[model samples]
Target chain A: MGMPLELNTMIVTKGREKRVEENLFVLVKEGYRLYPIDIPIDVKKTMDSDSSGSAVIKKVEWENSSTTITYQLVSLNSTN
Target chain B: MGMPLELNTMIVTKGREKRVEENLFVLVKEGYRLYPIDIPIDVKKTMDSDSSGSAVIKKVEWENSSTTITYQLVSLNSTN
Candidate 1:
């Protein structure tokens, strides 16, 4: 059998992201997933939320069945 | 041009790994990389080092030009 994995084109933070630095954020997710690197992708507070901003992932770490990602916000669609 | 990516069949930790549980470990590496999911692969302290163990990758994540993998040690070839 194979592990369940997902390929994503966006970041749905679900309000669990932590600000690691100015314009940079880190988020941890459950399970194995894939995202495009060095490219811009949409970021939202949730899957159903409106697009909040654009970000470029700078690092991703997976361990203990969790995925941790570091990203930098490139642009914001709205302030609120 | 497309992003640079590597498909890896083994893990060379280089002593940069953190043990999360008894048999589970996490490793993060620079650059986008791919590993087989749910299958056993070689694990070593370095590329030149002998295989330390066999591990089944449970998760692989790519982001920001880095690859993160979570694996479970299945069998060890040595005690050291």
Candidate 2:
């Protein structure tokens, strides 16, 4: 048998006031043990002249520990 | 050099009235031309006794055309 892998996906958006908020999905798994892991932002970029996005993944805590990963998307202003 | 690959990510959610709604991301690319492609639902599942999720991808229209993939997440009732 192999270790289980938990997969999670999230879409982050900025509110009308430009406040950052995240809508998180409950941990979902197919055939692996589910564990909560934090994902770090691997990359961030702005696009479409309006939106900013970031990719994040949880740091690997242990060699055999289950991990959860998440990505955040946001909108950026031209000035910033 | 290899063909360009366009990547898009979306987080879909159900509204207060149990209506399915999707927050779409404008096409974002790293180093490829982006052509709008529809993503079909490949898999669907329910989790946490509350949320229903589905993975979708656009059918491969051409041998070397850019593709766009999207995943939709929605809340489900236990009855269905």
Candidate 3:
């Protein structure tokens, strides 16, 4: 069956450390049932600051089941 | 518009190291354009042997665009 769905993308920075980490851990713990794959960091972009970086995180949540799978594009240099 | 699709899942063991790694790298390099989320591993099962482990990998590819996103659930102990 084809399911109608919406995809959400988030760009997280180093300053959002706590939020990002928390979200990531949650996704890691519960993502498998929703997605058949592992979340990978594909593209990374570094900003001017040493401690801050920008990344694109893709999260796919099933509209019917409410299950979610999250993937992260981490800045290679970002400490978080 | 909703697209008709099929999802493929693979179970990989340590013996298929090279194939698994190659497929993973390809998915990483080309996955973003397909899905909006990162792939995560929620469950891992370890076998009797020390060097081998088993995992489930989910890959989503667009039938028309031919874009693919790959997620890996690696055996935590698998070296490669």
Candidate 4:
């Protein structure tokens, strides 16, 4: 049998992201999801929200039925 | 060129693990490494140490030249 996994092309933080360092942020979500590493992806506050910035996913961790991702903001669509 | 990756069959915590919940732990280490997910693997305090327990890796994340892993301890070899 195969494990259920989701391949994501963008991030939907939903206002639950923590800044670990300058331009680097971490977010945890509920489920087994995968994202392309070391590649730039769009970051949105919510799925329906506009693209807030572009980020490169550095790490993606799945544990306890949850997914944690670490990303670096490379470019912002808006400063506000 | 292909990315430099290491496939690891066991976990070497080096005493740097933090408990996330009962029987669940998180460990961060240097460099990008891969582990068998959803399967039990040996856990050790160090590369030269004996197996402390068996754990099932739930998640593995690589970012910023570092690797982060989350696993659940299934059995411990010692009580101490």
Q: Residues A1-80, candidate 1, lDDT per residue (tens digit)?
A: 65567888899999999999999999998887777778899999989889999999887766666778899999999665
Kindly list the per-residue Cα lDDT of model 4 for residues A1-80, writing each as its tens digit.
43566768899989999999999999998877767678788999988889999999888777777788989999999656
How much lDDT does each candidate structure score?
0.84, 0.27, 0.35, 0.84
Query: Candidate 1's residue-wise lDDT over B1-80, tens digit each?
Result: 54677978899999998899999998989888878777898999988989999999876777656777788999999675
Off by over 4 Å in 4: B1-36, B40-55, B64-80
Ranking by DockQ: 1, 4, 3, 2
Clashing residue pairs in all predictions, respectively, total 2, 10, 14, 0
lDDT of 3: 0.35
Per-residue CA lDDT of model 2 for A3-73, tens digit only, reads 23443232222221121346222221223222222333222222223334433322111111322223233
| lDDT tens digits by residue: candidate 2, B1-80 | 32234432322222211213463222211232222223333222222233344333221111113222232322333446
After the best TM-score superposition of candidate 3, give how far the Cα of residue B31 lies from its true spot, in angstroms: 13
Scoring each candidate complex against the real one, what DockQ results? 0.40, 0.02, 0.03, 0.35
Best candidate according to lDDT: 1
Model 1 residue B21 lDDT?
96
Instruction: Give the per-residue Cα lDDT of candidate 1 at B75.
Output: 98
Order of the predicted models by TM-score, top scorer first: 1, 4, 3, 2
Top candidate when judged by TM-score against the true structure: 1
- lDDT of model 3, residue B32: 21
